[model samples]
Target chain A: MKEDPFAIKVENVSKKFSRNLRRSLFLGTLDLAKSFVNLPPDTTKLRKSEFWSLRNVSFEVKKGEIFGIIGENGSGKSTLLRLIAGIFPPDDGRIVVNGNVGSLIAVGAGFHPHMTGRENIFLNGTILGMSRSEIKAKFDDIVKFADIGDFLDAPVSTYSSGMKVRLGFSIAIHRVPEVLLVDEVLAVGDISFKRKCMERMEDIRKKTSIIFISHDMRQVERICNRVMVIDKGKELYTGETLNAIDFYYKHTIAKEVQNIDPKLIVYESTGDIYNITLNITNEKGENTEIFKHKEKIVFEFNFESRSEYQNPILGLDIVSPEGITITSLKNVIFGHQRPSIKVGHNNFRVILEDNSLMPGTYRIAFKWRKQDNFSLVSATGGRFAIQSEPELVPFGGYFKVKYKWIQN
Target chain B: MEYKTIYTPNQRFKVNIFKTWYIMFRNVYDYRELIFQLFKRDFLMTYKKSFLGIAWILITPLVGIVNWAFLNYTGVLDPGETTIPYPAYVLLSTSIWGLFMGFYVASSNTLNAGAGFIMQVKFPHEALLFKENFQHLVNFTISFVIIITTLMLFGVKFSFLSIFFPLTILPLFFLGSSIGLIVGVINIVAVDIGRVINKLMELLLYVTPVLFASNTENENLQIALKYNPLTYLLGVARDLLIEKNVQNLDIYLIISLVTFLIFLLALRLFYVSEDRVIEKMI
Candidate 1:
C-alpha cells in the first residue's frame, strides 16, 4: 500500500447548525429516527432556522506541516476543528484523518473534577487513546511537563484553571498522536507555560502534523506553514501565511458594516487602513527572522491605506515573548513631524544599531495613529524576530545597556 | 496505532450498522483498562465521602427486606405461606430482584452515568456500560452474601440445584439490561422515559410477587404475576435455591432465549443511535 503525502484530507466538508435549540434537537433526533427503517438523511437541504456553519470547506494538510485556520468569533473555526477531531460528522463530503487524532480542543475534557491530578493523567491519557502501559511509561514526563508539583494528589476540582490547562496539555502532548487538533488552548496558560507549549509544539512538529486554529495572527505566522481564512463559514483564502492573513484583513473586517444602534460603532476606525505587513533585514541586507547578538537590524513596515494623510504617526513597540513590553518608539508629535502617505501604498523604516537583545523570541507590535488627534486608528502587524544565542549568553537580559559604576 | 476514523453522513452512517455490529463485542479489547479505571474511579469516589461507606451495599437490601417482613408480621399485608420462613423468602426474592434491577439501572443509565466523559471526550461509549456493571457486581456480591446469611439464620437448607444460582440468574441480568439499554437511549431524548421507567420498575416489583408468595389470594395480583415474565424467572430461581420443586422450567428456558435475542436487538439499537444521542448530549 502506498502512503499518502497528506496527513489529513477534507473534501467538500460542510457542517450545519441551528439557531433554535428546541428545533435543533427535534430535527436532530428526527434524523436519528430516520436512520432506522432504512431512511437516508437529506444533508443537502436546510430546514427552519437551520443554516450551514461551514460550507464546502476543503483543504489538505501535508505530513509534518502545521496548518492554520483563522477566523473571527462565530466564524465556524471551532466547528471546523471539531469536525476534524471526529467529534461530529460533516453533513456532506468526507474527512480522512490518516492516524490516531489527539484533540486539544477542550483540554482536561475527560478529567473528573472529583479525581486527583495523578489519577486524571491515567484516566485522561487513556481517553486520549493511549494504552495503560503507555500512560505508565510517560507518567513522569507528564508530571514534569505540567510542573504542578505537590498538587498531584489534590482533586482536579481544587486546581486553578491554569493548573488544569497545564496538566491537561501535559497529558495530551505526551500522547503524541499522528495528527493533533489545537483550538485556542495555547491562549489559556501563563507566559512561561505558553512558551513551553510552543516549544513543545515546535519539537513535536517533526513527527506529528498539526492543525492550529487561533485568532492571533502572530501565533499563526510564527507557527503555521500554511493558513486558511474562514469568514462566516466560507473560505475566503487559503495559502501562504502572510497572504492568507493579508487576505483575511482585506475581506473579513466590517469596514463598511454599521451597527444597529447609531451610538455604537461596530469597530473603531483603523485610519483608512487596508492592512499592514512587516519584515526585518540584517546588515548583509538579507531578510531573516533569527539574528545573532549585537547585530545591526532594520524594521520595515509596509502599510496599505484606503486614503492617505499627511503627518501620519506610525509607532512601534518591541515586546518580549513573555508579553512584556520592553520598549516603545514613536515619531515627533510636537511639530507633527511624521511620514506622509499616499492613497495606495507606503513604507516606513526604524533602525536599531548594536542590538544587544538576549536569548529568547521577541515580537514587533505596530500601531498606526491619526494625523490630527493622534488617536489610534488601527493596530496591525507582527513581524520580525531578534533571536538570541542561548548557548553563548545563557544569562543575558532583555538588552545590554552601556553603563558602568563610577568608583562606587 | 493504525486507526483511521473517517466521518461521513447518510451512507457512511448506514455502513456503520454492519460495521458496528461486527466489532460490537470483539474490538473493545483495548478499552478494558479504561473500563477498569472508570470503575475504580466511581467505586473509590463513592466510598470516599461517606462514614458508613461500602456498608450501605449490605444495608440497603436488608432494610428493604425488613420493611416487607414487618408488614407481613403485622398482618396489615397478608402474603401467602412460603416454603421457607417469611423473612427468608422475602430476603431471597428481593435480593434476586435487586440483582436484576442492578443490570437494568446500570445499562439504562450508562450514557448519563458517564455524563462528564460523554459530554467531552470521544472514546468507546460501550466501555461505560462495562464500567457501570462493575460497580453493580460489587453491590450484588455483598447483597448475595447477606441473602445467604439471612437464609441460614432462618435454618433453611440449600438445594443441590443451588449450584446453578449464578447460571440460572444469567438470563435475568441480560433481560434487565436489554430493556434498560433501549430505554436509556430514549431517556436521552426525553427524560420522562427515565422517570416513567423508574415508576414502572416499582410497579413491576409488586406485580412480580417479589416479596409475597406467587399463589396469592388476590385474583388481580395473581393474574399480574402470571402474565409477568419476571414471575417465572424470579420465582423459579428462588425455588431452585432452596428445597425445590421448580415450576415453569421450560418457559424459563424459552424466556431466556427470547431475552438473549432482545439483548442483541437492543445492542443494535444502541450502536445505531449512540452517535446521534451523543450529538444531543450537551
Candidate 2:
C-alpha cells in the first residue's frame, strides 16, 4: 500500500506527568531552598520519578485519513491528542504537523459564560486560528448548522448542553483545518445531531486528516478507516478497526480473567470429595456455540459428591466485560434438590432462553453453597462472547424495539 | 518516486524567536475579525444593562468633578493657587489615568481570561491578551470623547495641541501592554503574581501623582516621581489640558523609546518561554 504522505508525524513521543500531586508547592519551596543553601539540585531523580503518560508512542497519520484511537479509560488517547495539538511539549521525542491543526478536545471548552453565543463563536474561531474574515464568511453557515437561530445572540451560559455542543461542533467544523483532532465530543447531543456531526466529519475527511478518540466501539467501527488500541500507555494493536477492538477486548478483558489467581476461585462449604465441570451451550443446543443476543444459553454442570447434604443452592450469572451483571439465575427459587452422588458424579443443568442482552462479550460464572449456612462451596467461570446475528437483529445492543416512520 | 525526494526522512524542531513572532503576528492578524467582534461585544454589552446607557460614560467623570469640587470647598485642595480649576484638573488626570489603569488591568489578566483557548487552540497565545487590551483602548477612547465634551461645557479653551493627546497615549498604551504581557505570562505559571499585581497597583495609586499633585519644591519626591514613567505621562496630559504648554519633550521621547524597547524585549521573552512555561503551568 502506498503511504498518502505523512500529514502528522509523531516520532518517539513520550509525555511524563508529575505523579506526585502534592509536590507542586513543595517542589517550588525546594527549589527556593536549594538556591539559598547552595546545594546541587537533585533534578535527575525528580525527572525519573515522573510518570510517563505516553511512552515512546509513535505513529504516522496520512493526509485525509480518519485515524481512530480506542482504549479503556486512562489509556492516554486524550493525552496523545493533546500532544499532537501542541497543548504541551513532549518531554522526549517530537511531533511534527505539516499544516494547521484544530482540536475539539471537549465541547464548550473555550466558551466564556458571560460571552454571548455570537461572541463566543468569534472568540473560539480566533482561538482555533481562523481569521476574522474567515469566521465572518462562515458565520451564517455555522449558525445555520448549529440550529440555534435566535439564541446565538444570547449568552452561552443560557444554552443547553446539547446547544453548547452543537455550536462548538459547528465552529470546529467550519475552521476547515488540515488536521482535526476530536475527542469523544460526539457522545453529547441528540442522535440526529450526532448523525449530522458524523456526516460533517465525513465531508471534512475528504480534505483533512482526523484523529478521533472515543470509548464507543461501534462508533469507531463506523467512522474510522483504521483504529489503534492503547493499553496502559502501550500500543496494543493498530490496524483494521474490527481487529483493534478484538485485540482490546482480548487483552483488557480476557487477559484480566487470565490473571485472576486460582486460589481466589476456591470457596468454603461442606467437604465433598467430588469435582464439577461447567459447560456452556448456545440457543442451537450445540456445545460449541458460545452466546448470542436474544438467544438461550444452557449452563450444564456435572458434579459428584461423597455424601448428600440437606439442601444445596446453585447460582449462575452472566457478567459483561466491565463487570456489569447482565443476568443471574438461582436454583433456590425453584426448590430443586441435588441427588446423592455416592462418591460418584451427578449432572445438573439450567437453561436461559431468549436472553435480552446487548451485543457484546460476556462471562458465565457458577456458584454452589449450602442452603442454611449460605456458605460458598465452589465457584468457577469461563468466557462467553455474545454477538448479534446480522440476519435477524435490527440493531445490536441490550434493548430491542421497533419504530415506524411516516412521510408527511 | 517524487514523494520519496519531497518527504525528508528527518527534520528537527528549532526554536526561533523571529519565526515565533512571525507566527504570533500572523495569527493575530488572521483573528482580527474576532478581535473586532469581541471589541464591539464588550463595548455594547457593558452599556446594555446600565440605566443611563452611554450617558454613564459622561456621568462617571462628572461625578469625579463633583467630588473634586467638594474637596476644593473643604480646603483639601487649594483652588486659587492651582493653574486650572479643580474640576478641569481632576477631569484631565482621571481621563488619562482611566485609560492607563484599564489597559493595565485587562492586559495583566489576559492569560486568565483566555486560558481555555490557549490550552485547546493552536494560535499565538498573546493574541487573546492583545485583543482584550485593545478593547480597553476602545473604551478609553469613548470615555475621552465624553471628557472633552464636558471640558468644553465648562468654557475651557481648546487648541490644536489637544489633538496630540491620542499620540501621547500611544506610547503609554505600548508600555502598559508590555508590562501586562510580562505579568500575564508570569501569572500563567504562578498565580501568586496575579494577586500581587492587584496589591501592587493599589500601592502604586497612592505613590503616583494621579490623585494628588507632586510638589515640585520637594527635591527628593520630585526625583522619585520623575523615575515613574506614569508620572511623566500624567504630567504631559495635565500640561496639555490645563497649563496649555508642552513640558519636557525629551522626557516624553525617552519614555516612548524606552517603552518600545521594553515591548520588544517582553515579546522576545514571551516567545522563548512560550512552550516551556505555559505548557508546564497549564
Candidate 3:
C-alpha cells in the first residue's frame, strides 16, 4: 500500500524533564559534553528525579487540517508545539514537518519596548521568520490591521498591552505561514479584536494547516476537523471533536471518583432493609456520563426491599453545581402515591423526552420517604453533564429554553 | 504540499559538528534582518528616556580616566616605565579596556535580556548575542573619538598605525564574545555563574595592564600578567597605536589564531546546547 503524505507527522516522541532546575542544568551540561564526542544519551535509564513530560506520543496531521489539542495545564501540549516549531528538539522518536512552521505561542514575544510600534512590527516579523521584503510589502496592512493609527510611530513602551497584542497578532497572521501553531493567544485583546482575529483565523484556515491548543472547548468543537485529548502527558483520545470531548468528560469523572469515599455518599442507610443503585443512560441503552442538550435520557433506579410498605415515596431532584434545583421528578407530583410497594427487588425508570437543562454538570439527588413525611434514606443518586449544542448561544444564565415566536 | 519535520530527543551531548554548523549558519543567515533589528533595539533602548542619553556611553571610560588622573595628581598612583605620558597612557588603555569589557558583559547578558523571546520563538538565539556585542561597537566608536582628541591635545606622536588599531582589537572582540557566550549559556541555567563572571571581570581588570602599567619588580605579579591573555592583546593594540612596536607581532598573531579557534569551539557548543538549554529555561 502506498503511504499518503502528511503535513506534519510526529512519531513515537518522548521528552523527559526534571523538577529540580539546578540538577537538570547539571545533567544537561553533562549531556552536552557527551554529545560533543558523538555519544548517544542514556534514554533507557532514569536518573534521581527526572520524569517523562511526553512519552511515546505519536500523531499525524494532514495538510490544511485544523488539528485541535485540548488538555489541562502541564499536559505536554506546549511542549509538543515547541517541538514542532523547532524551538526545541524532542528527546526520542521523530517529528516531520515538510513546510516552514510558525508559532503564536506568546504574543509580543520579541517586541522591544523602546522601539516604535512600526519598528517592532519589522522586528517581530523578522523574529517570526518573515524576511525584510515580506514585512515591507505588508507594512501598511499590518499597521492598519493593528488599528494603532497615530501610535504606529510611538514607542511600544507607550502602547497599551492591547495595542501591543494587536500589533503582534497582525504581523503574525499577515506573514501567512504555511503551518501555524497557535497556543491560546486568542484569550488576549478585547471582544471586537477577538472577533476580528477569529474571522481572520477562519479565513487563514482555508490555506494553512493549523495546530490549535486551546482550553475553549466551544472553539474546538466549532473549528477543529479533529481533536486530540491529552492528560498528564498521555493521549486520552484522538478523533471526532465531539467524541473526544465525551471521552474527556468520562476521563475527568473517572479521575474525580478516585478520591470519593463511597461511605460518605450514604447519608442514612439501613443496609439490611433496603438496597438501591441508580444508573443513567442515553436512549440507546448504553451507559453515558454526558448527554447533549434536549436529548432523550433514561434514569433507571433499582431498589430491593426486604418488606412491604404502604405509600412509600421516592423523590428525585436534578440540582446544579451551586445546589439550585433546575428540575425534579417526584412520584407525588403526578398524584400517583403508590398504594403499596411489595417486597423483593423492584425497578423504577424515569424517562425525560427532552432534558432541557443548560450545559453544565448537574447532580441527581434521591430520597425515600415512609408514610407521609418520614425521610428514610437520602443520597446523591448520580451526576451527569449536558454538552452544549453548536447552534445555541453560550448562555451564562442557567436552563436553556425552547419557545416559539408568534406573528400577529 | 506535504512537508516533513523530524524532531528527536536531544541525544546526550550528541556532537554532529557539520550539522551544528549548518543549522547555526542557516538560521543566522535567514534571520539576519532580525539580528540587525535586535542590535537596533539594544542601541535605542540603551539611551531611551535617559537624561544623559548617548552621553552615558562616554561616562564609563571618562570616569575611569578621571579616577586615574586624580590618583596620579595626588601621587597616590605611581607610573613606572611608560612609553607615553601618564594621563594619555591611562586614557587610551582604559578606553580599549572599556570596549572589551562592554563586549564581554553585553554578550553574557544578551540572552538574559531576551529570555522571553528565546523561550517563545524558534529563531537563531545567537543573533541576540551578536546583537548585544555589536551594540558595544557604537560605544567603542564614541570612546575612540575621545581617545583621538586626547592624543592630539597631549602632543603625542600618534602614528598612522593608529588607524589600524581598531582592526587589531577584532581578535579581542572574538575572544571576549566567545568567553561571554559560554558563560552566558551557563548563566541561563545557573544564575550564580553570571555573578561569578562579574566578580572575575572586576578582579581581572586590576590584574590586566589596563589602568596601571605592569609592576615589573614584583616577579610573581609580572609573570601572572605576562600569561594573562588580555595583557598581551592590550599590549599589541597599544603598541600598534602609540608605540609602533612590531617586535612581538608574532605573539599577537598567534594569540589571534588561538582566540579564533576558541570562538569556533564556543559557537559549536552554543548551537548544540541552544535548543535543549533554552527549552529547559522556559
- Top candidate (DockQ): 3
Ranking by lDDT: 1, 3, 2
User: Can you tell me the DockQ of model 3?
Assistant: 0.52
lDDT of 3 by residue, A111-213 (tens): 8888899888888888888888989999999998899999999989899889999999999889887789999998889999988987888898877889999
- Cα displacement (Å) at residue A244, model 2: 2.0
Candidate 3 Cα outliers beyond 4 Å, as residue runs: A1-4, A33-40, A253-354, A362-408, B1-4, B11-19, B68-80
Model 2 whole-model lDDT (C-alpha atoms) = 0.69
True contacts kept of each: 0.55, 0.28, 0.73
DockQ of candidate 2 relative to the true structure: 0.19
Model 1 interface Cα RMSD in Å: 2.2
Q: lDDT (CA) for every model shown?
A: 0.77, 0.69, 0.76
True contacts kept of 1: 0.55
> Model 2 clash pairs?
A131-B30, A132-B33, A358-A397, A358-A398
- lDDT by residue (tens digit), candidate 2, B117-197: 567765556666677888787667776776677667767676557767677787777777777776766665455755797
Q: Write the per-residue lDDT of candidate 2 for residues A1-408, one digit (tens) a residue.
A: 555487788877776556664454345334333422333233323353466677777888888899999888888888788778877666567778867778988765667776889888887776677777788999999999999979998988889888998998899888887889999999989999999998999998988899999977778878888888887677778887777766665555444544433222445546573466677776555774335556787877776777665566667877766677666787665545654234467787788765766555666665666656465465656666555343332254554545798999
Candidate 3 chain A lDDT trough over 10 residues, lowest sum: A255-264
Best candidate (score: TM-score): 3
- Candidate 1 chain B weakest lDDT stretch, 10 residues: B71-80
Better of 2 and 3 by TM-score: 3
- What is candidate 1's TM-score against the reference? 0.77
